[model samples]
Target: MTLDVALSHRFKDFALDVAFEAPAGVTVLFGRSGSGKTTVANALAGLLRPQSGRASINGTVLFDTAAGVWLPPHLRRVGYVFQEGRLFPHLTVRRNLLYGRWFARGAADGASFERVVRLLGLEHLLARRPGALSGGEKQRVALGRALLSRPQLLLMDEPLAALDEARKAEILPYLERIRDQTEVPILYVSHSVAEVARLATTVVALDRGRVVRAGPAAAVLSDPEAVPTLGVREAGAMLVGRVVRHHPDGLTEVALSAGPIFMPRLEVEPGVSLRIRIEAKDVIVARGRPEGLSALNILPAEVATVRRGAGGGVIVQFRAGQDLLLARVTRRSADALELIPGAACHLVMKSVAVAQADIGEVAQAD
Candidate 1:
């Protein structure tokens, strides 16, 4: 399913005008606070009606101002997962999930309650109430509830924003499972670059009520031109690889298209595909493959683009085998090394620089 959205709305203090196409898989609406991310999600879910706009899922128009069509929230087959679980305080987990299933009474592809519970690992908590679950567990039940509605699209508005790091970590894998296992397309709103890197198949970057960038996650994340909009500190590149083996020294070897790279141990088994995020700030560019370095991962690459930032830093994009990676270097360092398009260099990354949170299992191929 493809989500096409074009909206224009006027508020007392802000005017929102944005348009983007979200293809199948998780399409993340990313930006800083007050960038209209939630506004877009609300528009899609029929919670807000823009002054003039059109929204459609695979040609099924939910709203078209020009045509005078507007589907109410209950009539739109779009499941919404808010930042809070918003589960019933008096109901058991089973009942709360069933409430969503009730809306799918006549749907042809309503999700099975048992399958939803298993998919979210909610079997153990089914008999418990919302008060008995942790933040992550509550979110899982919320997700299961959303899935059970059998919506054609899912709208998630910073579902992880309210959680601390530990809770966020706990729920990320389940979100990945939903992205991989379900056919429903998702419009996820988030300000977190890490979440975008780990879960987004496509990214639509918004800035102050407008779309600044939109494309595949890899292309958008690695684009040097997008560094300013994505926040220089949060800019990064993603690499997809398969687990090769685990070493006794407490490291896991993953084979990237560029070559083999080692990182802190991962719990996943050998041959499992993984997506790794390498932040531009965490990378060091060397003109030559340096020896005697503390870093364990180094890949040969050719400079693809170099753009100077407002400050003294320069964002450099380089191609390593089939993948592109990003590096943020000082202007002085870039000039010293003569970094330019086609210039050869090596990306030096410390094995420990890759945080456990930045590594995620890639969606299984269909």
Candidate 2:
């Protein structure tokens, strides 16, 4: 359940040097474009060779320059889902998926075609061609094709980059299913903060081809110092909660460490756990529990750290119960409230501010 990576390569202008260990869940290579995120993915997939590096999955060495261990692409047994589907337009979906079997080096090790199709919800569209499918469907097919190959590790290079917001929304749940239901580890690349918030169990932050931050998703994302590189407004907190109940008036109540949180109704049953992403910009810091506020969520918290941003804003890290919450507030507002380390306050936000795409349901075990 461990994937280790260390790569160093010299390019014309950019150089890639990174080392990190990704656990069993989805590990994201997160950064802006041209930050060597894809280079790492490519190195892992055997598409590009690093001048010096070592990669291993579950103790199986994929490449190690010092050891002269260089397994070719086919021998790597890594599944790749590119930005485009890359499916054969001439072939039906079923045939395209079956094409992955041609590269199977061994018995596929119990990864059958039926199980993959069922997992990806590709049953109905199996008879169609790539040209007739939607962007989301095409990507799902691509994922299935990769899964059918029975990869030791899955490499996804911005698989959702080609999709619109709607399309991304449609396919995210399926990817979540893969992350929770499957045993194979995933190396996913993305620049979207929303996607990283929802999909990443481990995050490797890259900047100018350097590994700036690499750790659990909660620890890396909650640090205000890292927000400047990730984008100030995009900084946020990921909170775990369980569905309490669905009200008849169209609001869903989720019990968090802070307290009960009310949000726009989610179409899910009670007792379901979720990871809720609340943007730092969306949180309002209140000096005390105030009245007459229209915001639906008011959580009592203690300020832990306040880091000034590049602009007029400041990133306020606070503790709400056992969870850490981040708020982006103007310096003037922070001064007005005299916010500082260990200051007691309350965080506020409207229920509707939580977009559907920002919430990820935790898949239950079998």
Indicate which candidate wins on TM-score. Answer: 1
Q: Candidate 1: RMSD over Cα atoms?
A: 1.0
lDDT by residue (143-225, candidate 1, tens digit) is 99999999999889999999999999999999998998878889899999899988999999998899999999999999998
TM-score per model over all chains? 0.98, 0.97
- In the range 1-366, model 2's lDDT, one tens digit per residue, is 899999999899999899999988999999989999999999988999899999998899989999999999988889999999999999999999999877775754736889889989999999999999999999999999998888889999999999999999999999998898788789999998889888899999999999999888877888887896687769998888899999998999999998998998999899999989999989998887989988889999999999996679889999999888899889999999999998999999899999999999886531
Model 1 error, position 70 (Å): 0.6
Clash pairs (backbone) in predicted model 2:
none
Backbone clashes for every candidate come to 0, 0
